[model samples]
Target: MPVTKLYIDKEVEDYSNVREFSSRIDLEGEIVDDQQVIFDIIQESSDPIQKAKEVIFLTRNKGAFIKKCPGTSIYTCCGYKILHIGTFCDMDCSYCILQTYFHPPIMQYFVNHIDMMTELDRIFEEKAIHRVGTGEFTDSLIWEKWTDIASKLVTKFSKQNNSILELKSKTVNIKKLENLNHNGKTILAWSMNTPHVIKEEEKDTTPLKARLRAAQKVESWGYKLAFHFDPMVFYDNCHEEYKDVVRQIFKNVSPENVAYISIGSFRFMPDLKQIIQKRFKESTLVYGEFIHGLDNKMRYFKPLRLKMYQAIVSEIKLLAPDVLVYFCMEDDEIWEKTFGFVPDKDEGLSKMLDKRVAKLCGLNKGLLI
Candidate 1:
């Protein structure tokens, strides 16, 4: 195992629990890696864990576990749910929001599992059919190379009947998930992009074929699977590329085995354009026909967005019409234009998605539609 060298913020070192955790990790009198940089923001924080939670560092934040999702109201359009985990990613996607979303971007894991389970138990007791994911802020399975967090979560969530956990990632790290006692309460999701996008924009991610193969392995393991084609970047021959990807997915995994599929066009905050230019000069995704959205972020022109969504949805529908398909952070106009139905007409989008998820996983017993 490659040990993660954690740097305890000076201010947090005085806490008994923090001290104990540091001792367990052998933090004292250890030589720092020449490649690692020491971050001092934690030293200035009164509650180091809370501050550490917001900042991504190479250290483990041994603090309070679990957190509320910081999603905007628009998150409801895409089945918003609480993300107990914070920002941490190993793959380097050029257009990833985490580059700017987290200060001092580094991979940090919160090791306080007991408190997290307690909080989840309370949330699950509400019996509200909540949909929660660890992938929202981070690639859910990226940490598996270092920690068996997904296995722990899968085993823990297997016992809960009221909530479902979605582990979304672009890696083929399903080894940690094999032979787990999953009760169909967890969705092992994969975030996919066109082969061109994967080659150009995403770095250190598993190949699309490998990801689909892994999804098939999970399906064979009796686990529900999900797929997302988020940030569907538009380029020359994008339609053909995306269509090929859909075909590949259907060929590898049956639609019946897929619990849900989500599609979204490329959208980015204006500031990210400069960051991409500075860090990833070769990326052309920033050069698309973009306009400032209502949220003052740059997105595809409304018509282009609608066209891309329509095309991708049509392709997915052709392969798996019955699979639960939805958009991420889109509005009523876009929804109607693409799917021909407003989320409002049905119960809220979240409930509709949750119900579909329940039915797919055989958990819809008395589940509210």
Candidate 2:
């Protein structure tokens, strides 16, 4: 969390919560006249992308807090809901879409918790099974040093019976969560990768062993867990390394405590390639065997991706076969070839995940439980 500069929204300067959030930080603060200051800072930066992580923005989310995941119809979608808490991350990953998804990616912390609570209250009243998460746009736990955002969301979801909150991050920030009355309504998840990948590609993230140790602590605290082997890169000796990662997972926590596991191959938009090329020229990920997908992103060749996934899925099944395993934004051909059937055919992927949530966390009456 190298927040060298802080930009406070003028409108939120008087709010006590915002004031409290900014009080303990050591960085110098500037009272911005308006949100345009964001664009100005980006335009003025000598290196906008790098400078983006060097600064933090304390602002309000004027838009709706809740949004549907922008899943493509060309694939079998999971239908997960995104709680737009904030955008951008403090950590740097060579394969991160944040570098290209948002121009001049900035670490934004929405100070308006009331707006978030208001939206969540409405969703809880709807009483429909919903799989909601705060990790879509940012590392959900990155703002823990200044804000109790993770604690607040956990407490709120504890009393709800229809929706479960998934806080996914590469960092180990689970201290605030252990004391909260989450009532198994929260899924404490970690993004897993090989030690080689973590050391080479993921910058400033917790080490793999430390992340698993944190998961062990959270599991002991009685929170249901989840893991994502996403952006599963097809690098040198990746198969054995990933298999070892799966073994490490079961070594730390029981399979029954897991809510689900998600696996996704590395896929990114075309423009992101240039950003990686310019920003991380030494990265070999950009030079891998890739083909343009229906969604216009460059993905690994089908057979190659399947080989990598098959190796990983086989390892995971050996350790935790009963744990629900799914892909992130892949098509029917990939799913059918990998699992012998598409999850979309029996019941929608979203429904299956929701049922997992309901069964594991007691969100509602689900057969899986």
Candidate 3:
């Protein structure tokens, strides 16, 4: 559903972004002091999650905009920094954790660009290899129609040499990025899944072929690419299906241009089980073999996850041996069994990614390049 209602926070009512977005939106925005009023309105709907997507709350980000990924202690972290651009997405995925992550699950876009840029300036000044992304909280390209934030960010990152900005999304809004002077400082990424999974579980998303076509377009523009096969569902012939996805990825873009590819099996918090049952009544994703993991979430049994990972990793290595392939949240056992080695404990996965960034993005971090 498109955004039909707009709510502007009283504190950010006078910001320039508010005026620009308000003019672009055909609907009249209602300026409000308390956000509870919007929450109460959404609570009365039969489907509040769907209702939340229909309205946007533009507010100031009173806190820090840059934050570290909240990786669990038991899992290997990628040491990525999150540029908290917004909260919640417009698309509806049956297995989306955001459905139960936020209270009442409202869609919010922060209008405080001054504060956001100030934080990014600090990151650019530091002599470090930083992988920053805006897709952690929401789809990175969903705001392209109403705002020029993506263009602004890509331009700013182009002028720097210490960090790379990654824009990950399921949308094909690359028209604005084509003419930018990114200077190898921006990476375009996608969250890829099988056609069966996309059609059944993911809704209101670009099709698999369309997303790949967009990736090809971005590659032609000379940008480094990344693909993530996350939440890989377990089902009959799932191994073959995932291998096919790996095949399609290399078929579209060269392995030499790929910065990294990550694989993670389907895992969910216990609270999300009920939400999936209540909202997606026909979904069988929760029926797979599950066990309580170290982080207290329900994950596929280790053997099952290992089987899938081995098949997928073997296919990727066969096709693109030099491309970096890593697991998202798997443990040492999975790494040792699948790849015959584990990352060093001190630098671990983060160091591996930093080296890739320096080599591919040409950052002078004193690591690889």
- Candidates' C-alpha lDDT: 0.73, 0.87, 0.90
- Tens digit of per-residue lDDT, candidate 1, span 1-369: 123445544433344544454555554523234313444554455532234434333333354345555545653464456555545565778888876675555456554556677777887777467778898778898666546678888988898777788999998988978999999989999999988899999877889989989998999999988889988888888877888888999999889988888888888888778778776778888987788777667888788777777777888889899998888877778988888878774447778787887777656457675
Candidate 1 RMSD to the real structure: 5.4
- Pitting candidate 1 against candidate 3, the one with the higher lDDT is 3
- For model 2, how does the per-residue alpha-carbon lDDT over 16-101 read when each residue is reduced to its tens digit? 76777778677667889876778678769876788888788888999988999898888777778899988898888988998887
TM-score of 2: 0.97
Candidate maximizing lDDT: 3
Give the alpha carbon lDDT tens digit for every residue of 96-182 in model 3: 888888889888999999999999999988867889999888889998878898999999999988899999998898999998889
- Give the Å shift of residue 121 in candidate 2: 0.8
Weakest ten-residue segment in model 1 by summed lDDT: 29-38
lDDT of 3: 0.90
Which stretches of model 3 miss by more than 4 angstroms?
367-369
Which of 1 and 2 is ahead in TM-score? 2
Worst 10 residues of 3 by lDDT: 360-369
Order of candidates by TM-score, top first?
Answer: 3, 2, 1
